[model samples]
Target: MSATPADRIQLTGLRAQGRHGVYDFERARGQEFVVDAVLELDLTPAARTDDVADTVHYGELAERLVAVVAGEPVDLIETLADRLLAVCLADPRVDVATVTVHKPEAPVPHTFSDVAVTMTRRRAR
Candidate 1:
């Protein structure tokens, strides 16, 4: 994975219920999914102007991300991560967006901590 840029807006541990897995039961009974999003962009504008418009509105971002998790059913957390990344990248100011989706209550036979998938996307030149 690439290192995150110096100027970043980090939103972590966004919890939402989602029906996302391969099993039928998983799709029926939804489980909590946690998401983390890191956005890389120039913070100087916001810092200089001290204007919310100059930077990402994190509260709005959170709502949009939560909607995605609660909206549709998917087979894998990877796809979920991809969707989250897209949301972060929607802003024209964001140069890169990295997203991680965590399934703490994963249906694994063995004892484990968590199951997650992380993905990073950069704007196309």
Candidate 2:
């Protein structure tokens, strides 16, 4: 069976504050973080049946991601991206997942735009 159009959903640019950085001050003060998630699945059953049970609930997914990102302190945005990808793939309905985390205020000595990490994961058959 092929995936329907509704099966794909994107949760974009979710803003949150978290304590993640290599520096002590960055960890103490925290900073703004943006998360973007792309979830892929088959939604035909949900659309035909008109039942929430047949589909992935994006609200719940977002909540879970938020909890994980906000709960733990990590030094690397790579770790955060990996964790978010794991969370997304945990749902059986999700076949492919992409997670992006952006740190606008990275404590780099030089002036720059921002630091961002992006990762893509696929569920193992």
Candidate 3:
């Protein structure tokens, strides 16, 4: 919807359960985390060919990201974000990745809307 590189794939609202937080209860009980990602690449080749293999497979990418979110424990969302970015950038076609990790069930005493972390990474030259 927004202005972005002509070539990109976006995935949003990917949910998974994981034990990640500073509080012990958070790790013990575990909670849901939502991940959003934008992968940037040259889509011209895929667009012209109309071939699935030529473009990033977002469905498969979602599965990998879910695995990271549902995997090992981490103390901060920043760590989770980095891990997701790695997964996105793993694809050779992806030139850059922007990731957002959301912790809805955060260990906050008062009511809050949400807690999230966003990060962006570029494939190494």
Candidate 4:
């Protein structure tokens, strides 16, 4: 028999406050960071079994991201975005991952809006 198909799951707009920046002021006074993640995985087994183990648990995923962001100080959002992608791809169930990190209180000379870095990665077939 042919295998069933998988489904796409997305976790969006997970907000967290972290101190990550190249400037001392930014590091001293932490700022809000926004994360949006999209996880593509095979949900057939999980759906049939109705078990959390069979699928990617969003709680764990969010926790992992939190751990990474709060782990240490980083100079660039790009690095943070890269690390998050690595963490997501570590899960075997994940086929594709897109991570976006937003820095709202950036140290810009003039008044401006949020700055963010977004990247997409996929597991090797």
Judging by lDDT against the true structure, name the best candidate: 1
TM-score of every model versus the real structure: 0.95, 0.90, 0.93, 0.88
lDDT of 4: 0.85
In model 4, pairs of residues that clash are: none
Q: Flag clash pairs in model 2.
A: none
* Whole-structure CA lDDT of model 2: 0.87
Candidate 4, poorest ten consecutive residues by summed lDDT = 1-10
Residues 1-125 of candidate 2 have per-residue lDDT tens digits of: 64554578799988888998889997898888999999988878888999998987889988989887787889999999999999999988888888999998988889888789999988888
> What shift in Å separates residue 104 of candidate 2 from its native position after superposition?
1.0
**Tens-place lDDT digits, model 4, residues 21-77:** 999988898888889888777788888999999888999999999888877889999
RMSD of 2: 1.8
lDDT of 2 at 7: 70
Model 2 stretches with alpha carbons more than 4 Å out: 2-6
- For model 3 the TM-score comes to 0.93
Residue 7, candidate 4: C-alpha displacement in angstroms:
2.3
TM-score between candidate 4 and the true structure: 0.88
Residues 1-125 of candidate 3 have per-residue lDDT tens digits of 12248777889899999999998998999999999999989887778899999888888998999899889999999999999999998988788899999998898889998999999998887
Error of 1 at 71 (Å): 1.0
Off by over 4 Å in 1: 1-4
**Of candidates 3 and 2, the better by TM-score:** 3
The candidates, ranked best first by TM-score, are: 1, 3, 2, 4
lDDT minimum window of 10 residues, candidate 2: 1-10
Query: Regarding lDDT, does 2 or 4 come out ahead?
Result: 2
